[model samples]
Target: MDKIRNFCIIAHIDHGKSTLADRLLEHTQTVADRDMQDQLLDSMDLERERGITIKSHAIQMNYRNGGDEYVLNLIDTPGHVDFSYEVSRSIAACEGALLIVDASQGIEAQTISNLYLAMENDLTIIPVLNKIDLPGASPEEVSDEIVDLLGVERDEIIRASGKTGQGVDDILDAIVKRIPAPKGDPEAPLQAMIFDSQYNPFRGVEVIFRVFNGTFKKGDAVKFVNTGRTYNADEIGILKLEQEPQKEIAAGNVGYLISGIKNAREVKVGDTITHVERPCEAVTGFEDVKPMVFAGIYPVDTTEYEELRASMEKLQLNDASLVWEPETSAALGFGFRCGFLGMLHLEIIQERLEREFDMTVITTVPSVQYKAVMTDESIKWVNAPSEMPEPNKCSHIEEPYIKAQIISKSDYIGPIISLCMDKRGILKNQVYLTTDRVELTFDLPLAEIVFDFFDKLKTISRGYASLDYELTGFRQSNMVKLDMMLNGEKVDALSAIVHRDKAYEWGKRLCEKLKELLPRQMFEIAVQASIGTKIIARETVKAMRKNVLAKCYGGDISRKRKLLEKQKKGKKRMRQVGNVEIPQEAFMAVLKLD
Candidate 1:
């Protein structure tokens, strides 16, 4: 147990966390040269293409120092704020964290937040200045920032370049020396916490867990404390680049268990796995994930509803943070109301569903969960715009608020502040971390940042700003459900709840966007945005005329008028029965209507 050091790498996005991890793997010889690759821990194709870690990956490394050998369990965590849940799960299973900061970029918002998270969990933090290979690398300045942030000695901060494999040995040495070994009793009854999981179609659900006590042997009957379900472990193994099968994995070790459990829902992340016969007290698990954005995900072909559900369940096993329940929409038919960490999270899930499961889905306009207080003083939760109660019935509405932390250079502070202000963000505090780097805090509606806010911030700051946010609780706001109507009928999928002050303008923009996206039909399509019965904005897509008067080229004025009247009557009838088939892009257009 003393030789087993479990740790994770935490950093802001694109801070060389994965690259540093690859070097560590190489230095330790955990992965052979023939098998080596950049971001080696990031196994998914999506992760590699996007140059982001969407999931936390754990692998065991064997390090030899002097005559002794040590086992290192390293979890490479995602750096994006949307995948912070992945980082938290990794943190929960580890005893320490490698806080990697970009030498040139210094410290950013996500770095500070992730560090706080590790600190909260009592994990030892080893600060490392990465990306020193860059021409702009400023190790001295970044080291000072690290010292001020972590209060660590100057020499304690290791300067490393992941690209050139510099200081990789020092990082390994630090992990062995600084991070404490896991503490658990082998004699105690089995108590293991499942930190992460992945779906295997041929082999059933594979559970990756850390053993806190006792031993997990092949063929041991294990019970999930949360679900009260028991299954025989068909195979038990330690994780390497591949699963190294083992007869048993003892306490203080991380390993995988394949129980031949076909159902994904049966296995839950953060659930405690114990021996069914001699079970120890259930271990405490990680906190439940709080989903920040809600959207309805429906099958493009409605007949594939059940298949989509299965795909979602399997996906949920891999991504435990995804939350969903069955829902039906007037336009989209039956679907699941899925909740995600943020817009990026939502988009990734949608893309993965398409790529991995071969299930094409249409996602509705995303919305934040709202609190609607009734006149009788009862509060109702609204996850969709369609769920919002009438203004007459509700006393007031409260939208989810977030404490947003944005770190950026001083030169862009003015534009950053204005951008946040445009999103109805109230500046709460601002501090100069240094002469050039500034950290600003704002209290903003979660819905305000749901769409284009991050993109706009990146544009305004010229990609220099980093943002991290946490829910601050619900606050009273003058918000209304803005409904989009096509051909006089409301499309529930097109509706969104917006602040009252911006509803008219938002409605106008939305109507214009739909006008551009919706295909023209035989009849004039009236695109209207409404609040209750009041139409706030409207746009018209003119009907496609067939030149009905071509056959009567020299007709009298009265005859022309008669033919025109006939054509008008036909248009009115077509408009009544016409169902505007909203193209998929229209649903996403609401996000870019600005």
Candidate 2:
């Protein structure tokens, strides 16, 4: 046990957390000469493509120095703020965290946030200043800032260029000295914390956990403490950070367990697994994560709804963070309104679902929570535009707001400030980092920042801006819920929360975008935007001309007749708005800007 060390590396997004993991694996000779691959811990194709760690990965490494062998249990954690909850769970499984800070860029907002979480977990932190090989590297200055900001001893900062393998030895040495080995009763009942899990077709549910008490082996009957579900471990293997697996993972080790259990919900994160003969209490922090953003997710083809549902279920089995419920929208025949941690998380899940399941999806406009006061003095939470109380029935409405902190270059400050002001942002404070950089904080509506705000900020700052935000509770303000009506019926998926003054402008923009993306129909399509009882803008899509006449040949009147019959059937399938088949594309068009 004295030779074992369990730790995770935490850093801001794009701060080289994954890169550092790769370097460490190489430095420790964990991977053979021919088995070299970049970002080894990032095994998933989606993770590599997005250049982000979507899931936490654990791998074991054997490092030898002076004829002494040390087993390093390295866990790679997601750096994005949206997946902070997962990061915390990963931290809880480890005894320490390597706080990697970019030497060129001092501690950013996310760096501070992750650091605070690690501190709260009572994990020993080893501050490492990374990226020292960059041209703007300032390890010494960052070291000083670490001492002042984190209240750590200046000598505690380890400087290393994860890219060039400089000072990596010292970092590993520090980890060996600082991180404590696992302390548990190895002779007691078998118990482990399921920190993470994965689903394999061949293995069913592959649970990755750290044994805290007794040893577990293949064919052991274990019961999940929370769910009380029992499973016979068919296979138990140790991860060597390689393709091949090792046998017999004992207490004080991190590895995988292949149980015959097919249900993913039964084996949850933070749940304790104990030998059925000797039960144990479950670990804390297994609460289900509540999603903050909700959006309608529909298949491109209505016929694929069942297939999409099955695919989502399989995906959810591995990723318990994703929440979904069956929902039906009048405009979008049948679909699921899914909830996510944030925009990036939503995008990642969408991309993964499409890539892994081979399904085309149309998503609706994302929305934040809204507090509505009904005529009878009843308060309710509104997540969809269709769910908004009737105008006359609503007495008051409030939307969620956020406190945002933005860091950017000085020359772009004017444009950043202008953008913020245009989004109904209230400036709270601003400070100059240097002659050419500034940090600004503002109180902005959550709805405003939820969509394309980060993209706009990057464009305005020439891709030099860094922004971070946290929910600052709902506030009473002048706001209106705008609804989009196709023909005469309302589309709940097309609703939005906008300031009273900007409702007309938003409505006009949405109407035009929808007009361009919606396919031509047999009858005029009406796109109307309304605020309560008032209509702000409207557009009409003229009838489309059938092009079948030009293609009829080879005595294919049967084909032509079939085409006409199919078109008639399509027309019949569509919701009649005057006389038109409003394609699913039309509903999807409202979700995005042109």
**Model 1: per-residue Cα lDDT over 1-594, one tens digit each:** 989999999999999999999988998899989999888988889999999999999999999998789999999999999999999999999999999999999999999999999999999999999999899988898899999999999999988999999898899899999999899998889999999999998999999999999988899998999999999999999999999999999999999999888998898898999998997777774799999999999999999999999999999999999999999998999999999999899989998999999999999999999999999999999999999998889999998999999999999999999988888999999999999999999999999999889999999899999999999899899998889998889999999999989999999999988888888899999999999899999999988998878888775888988999999999999888878888999988987787
Score candidate 2 by TM-score against the native.
Answer: 0.89
- TM-score per candidate, in order? 0.99, 0.89
Clashing pairs in 2: none
Query: Please, what are the lDDT tens digits per residue for candidate 2 over residues 28-63?
Result: 988886887778888889888878888888888888
lDDT of 1: 0.93
Query: Which one is best on lDDT?
Result: 1
How displaced is residue 341 in candidate 2, in Å?
A: 1.6
Candidate 1 to truth, TM: 0.99
How big is the RMSD of model 1? 1.0
